[model samples]
Target: MPPCTTPNTTELVMIMDVESILHMKEGLGETSYSQNSSLQKKSTEAMKHFIIDSALAAYAFKTPEIFTIADLGCSSGINSLYLAEEIIKAIHERSRQLERLAPEFLVFLNDLPTNDFNAMFLSFPEFNMKFKAGIELQGGSAPSVYLAGIPGSFYSRLFPGNSLDFIYSCYSLHWLSQVPLGLLDSDCKPINKGNMYISNTSPPAVSLAYFKQFQKDFSLFLKSRSVELHFEGRIVILMLGRRTEDHSDKCTTVLWELLDQSLEIMVSQEIIDEEKVDAYNVPFYAPSAKEIKDEVHREGSFVIDCIQAYELSTSTGDPKEDARIISMAIRAIQESMISHHFGEAIIDTLFQIYSGLLSEFMVKEEIKSSHLLVILRKSC
Candidate 1:
């Protein structure tokens, strides 16, 4: 028999086609479920703003058949469905003023291969019923909405050129598909066996490493969006970022450092590997305004419709509750780490470290004010 051939990254990327990526987001085994009342409330409220803003922005497009929307990185949660409803209402109201036909919508629910689409599909029936009921109660035609799960990095694919009218991604992106190899060595060996970045404290070199990677990835994302978006399309990118008094360090990055220190204690106790600890990176990056501005300018595609930043407090008093939120918050980050390293054992240990740190951090101080919202529009 011919010598066995191991698959490389290129081959793996092919296998990870859109469908495979969707399955991954559906996650392994049964879909894990949770109800984050706080997150749900905040997310719903923020989404309303996006809906209204997007509707207003749609005026620039000025056509009923062209009205469309997509939720990039729409993981297995009720949020996407919620956004769909809000968008429909907002657009319908906007349409009335323009003397336009009731606009039909094409909504794309997207995420990675390792998400929980099954759970989201399971919830669709209820979503439809609720949406239809709401339309009837309002004495309006139920807007035609088509939902599809588009898998793969939102930075990539997302949609074909000029195919989308509006795009939204909440609490996602900022996840570099892979850690920067430069952070490791000339040999290109992975440093932390696949981590968010060596520790959350984000020492100078490591923090810079993450920023560079994000800038590169985000630049590509902007280029992709430029090509994929129609003239005057709108995109709402809402996620977590940090606020800081000192301008030297990126605010969101500083919060990551605090989280790192919390886990360093575990590293000292041998609960986690000190080397692996420093080698990882988070799926999310708390990007600075400067960084975001520079990237957008470099891409030269999107017009800065708006880039408002807000400081939101995310904290839970109880230890168990804190652990759950921390785990969920860092799920994508950790998964990115694991996929790069190629091991399940490390995943188990990372969770152990995360649990310990989350608990300690809860009593020690606070991990709030690292959340933000960013909205952009494709330049005419």
Candidate 2:
């Protein structure tokens, strides 16, 4: 997250063309996100109550006849509809209580341009059937659900002004728009060598660079979203985070450090290129709650309705079985980026190493994952 200059048209082409690399671009046959996404399922379920409650609060006012919603960073999977369905259920319940007609919903499922939109659109039939039945079961009037896939980076403009009533994002936002500049030396050699994210060995400049990038991308996110959302619209963002203010917290640190270790061993055995490892830095970060709140305040468009942090499990008791699933889940989201740099030839080997490393870490005592859930209401 280095200080990035405003890219010119041509530079922007290079800078913004990360869709080819930083996404879960796989289709449905194999290596799909849908197959490896149980962790995300747990993450979503953990946040369910907050999502439902937020919808209730936002709709307690005058519920619109044509309610518009967007799920930003909705990777190609049925999970994209999970929060949306919760919102729909809440709306139905409230409408039933008030003896009113439930409003029709227009949902925009957004992701990086390279995301598996085909898979998402393909799931619509089943989703629609469920949508119809769910409303009926709630004893409320059936509200039509319209689905559209918006392929673009949410860091920039997506929808028109005042177009969205609710915006929901989960397991995203931690992804920076692109890798930070200045991560490489003058010769384009890596500066933050041997680590994908901030590590204890990283220089202070590395963290500063990342911080600045998050600030810039998040500001753009707010500016665009503020314009797209109706007054009093609500958004809920759930992302992997850290409980402690320290950037060097161990809970968030172990995975990457172990990956670096595995890579180092591979380098010694000449199984992978050392220079490639040095040049690679992930476009992800686990920002502190203060970081999120500061950006929300600075953006000046949204009022914070609620902010809660939860500790999630990095273990599920079945260590050996959970290890493979968790590793594939990480690989599914990150394979594009890893393969682009490390080559697909080493992917299987690299993930095997990662899985072993992850298993070793998960079995340790009392590890808690820090997750932050923030709900915001667009100002009048």
Candidate 3:
């Protein structure tokens, strides 16, 4: 047989395909998503009460014998299972309060096809046992719970019409289905050069491109879920966002700016070419609350139940430790894209430089990320 072959970084970047390449770092290794996702877990914990309340509300709305739920962008980590268990427990407790039989649950765990599902599946046995033991302690009948992985992008349809009762997604919507095509010119050259994302120095067109992509992708998301959800089905989404309407706000772009600074350092040191840095642009966007509300209203499928803004500090009172933790967390999420774009050789050095930059920045200023919690009910 001929030797195996795969596309190179340049080839992949030229096409601007994110769905084919975007995935968190896999497995249980030191740099794995499972190891470095404490930041995400913190965000989830902060919103845990809202998540539980939303699940209960959905359960109360439709007491179906087989209650179906889906967690979109369920990356490989214990956090995914943790959220699932929370929903299951909330619905189970609500059934107990009503003195009625609990509904059998069908929990769908969804993510990109390249996600490390095997790593997630390996931990299910332990999760299931712990879940059952907890239910046994409460002295109630164990409701049947089933989980199956669905590998695909959420920008498209994932389920049959009127099949889902509830849906939950966290920290995943900021990623565009693909890098916005408007980022390129007629010559197919990157317009937002020397910056990995929307930045203070980027031109007006760059910000507009990012916003337009968000509008298109988010609208498609609502439309697809509208088809998949039962009437009045509920969705709880928590994702990275900004407090202001401006796309280049520091609250959202600081992390990417720091990463870009690190890449510039490498370019100055002649470790990587300047052109290489200029060619790369991150396929991510952090929207403002107003933007989200507008999109939901324009989509006309879901009525906004709640939309709130929250902040999570990336500080631990020690700048160095905070830098390490924050850099690791970002690496776990963005390494796949960065490595694919710049090659795997610079992974270690890049993050090391990033950590140092973050350390210095943290000592001068406290870094916090803004998040948006949106609860929508299918109304059309």
Candidate 4:
């Protein structure tokens, strides 16, 4: 864990234990990530080609007896299973086409300790039966798929050196290990007051602080993966990103801005303290393509095989319905953090205000989040 400190104070403050608190809303309820994660599923579906291509290329490189692949930040949901199934099916098809025995797969699903692994695992029996039956119907033998769970942050080492053959993460890497340090001033006051993330109103230092944190976290991630990945192993990452170099792009920051407004409403109604809102900051960053390239170059571990950007329009053309969907999606991701900081009692009210605000905003403007897909090969 890294220490965060104020410039004027000699005392060092440790970042909060994010792994203990950060997780998607559990179970299959309406508010759970399993129900509200269609946005993530959409991103995964859109990037299926890159994922399959990378997987096949990796298999072709080394036909190992046991193909070990891990999905970092594999949140508990159908989408997680969907990704795993896609990779397994693709590899199975490739082996059949080549008329070679399919390698047994060692699939590791990883996430924070707080993730609901039980719920995810409960669905596995059905998933396995369906997958195997589909393969048999195609007149091919199903490759043995061994599933295991790894609970930890990807910023640290989770696997033995030279163990992983392929890695995939979707809509997860944008989250920093913790909130950036230096967001508070020398006086120990929040510098990014009233904003959960970088916005136009935020000072330049706020953006720099976020970028610095990202660089440190991302570099650590690359270094850890570089050690774990076998030679020429590949990693495919799909994450929230920005189209421009600017960190405060409206496309990336609008969601946060609306949430900030929702918080402001609660503060005005005396439901929560203004100071608490000021001190709270989201532990996430949407990096640009250039920032990723620079970090990979600085880390000197992986060669970028492909990097592409695409936009996902979050609007469904109905302001009210879109607001509801978007609000639930954001709430599914942020409820745990917000509840931890502000209390669980305010969860319903906060997102209600958020949904109303989003409704109005959508009526005036469309919302789109930029996503970056990058495939990297371990080098040196």
Q: TM-score of predicted model 2? A: 0.92
Would you list the rank order by lDDT, best first?
A: 4, 3, 2, 1
Best-matching candidate per TM-score: 4
Tens-digit per-residue lDDT, 1-380, candidate 2: 54344533322432455666688847764567887888888988978988888777667755888888899999977587888887887787777789888788888999987888887788889988877886678555677888888988889999999888888899889888887665654544566878878898898878888888888988999999999998888899999887777777777776678778878888988998787677677787888888989999998999999887788775768776667876788788888877777778888888888888777766765346678899999995
| lDDT tens digits by residue: candidate 4, 200-294 | 99999999989999999999999999999999999999999999998889889999999999999999999999988887888899999999999
Q: Residue 178 of model 4: what lDDT?
A: 82
lDDT per residue, candidate 1, 1-380, as tens digits?
43223333532342334233322223333212233333644764855775567756765466757577777767665465777677777777767767677777777777776677677778877887888788779777776777777766766766888888788777666555654434443343344432343443334555666667778789878888788878888877776554542323443543355446645655676756666555444434567666777788888877776665676555655766776665654543344444443345455555566666667766766655555556777875
Q: Find the number of clashing residue pairs for candidate 2.
A: 3
TM-score of 1: 0.78
Model 2 residue 65 CA deviation in Å? 0.5
From the highest TM-score down, the ranking of the candidates is 4, 3, 2, 1
RMSD of each: 5.8, 3.3, 4.7, 2.8
Q: What residue pairs clash in candidate 4, if any at all?
A: none
Q: State the TM-score for model 3.
A: 0.95
How far in Å is the alpha carbon of 54 misplaced in model 2?
1.4
Per-candidate Cα lDDT values, in order, are 0.61, 0.80, 0.88, 0.90
Which is the winner by TM-score between candidate 1 and candidate 4? 4
Instruction: Give the clashing residue pairs of candidate 2, or none.
Output: 1-209, 1-210, 2-209
Instruction: Give the winner by TM-score: 3 or 4.
Output: 4
Which structure is stronger by lDDT: 1 or 2? 2
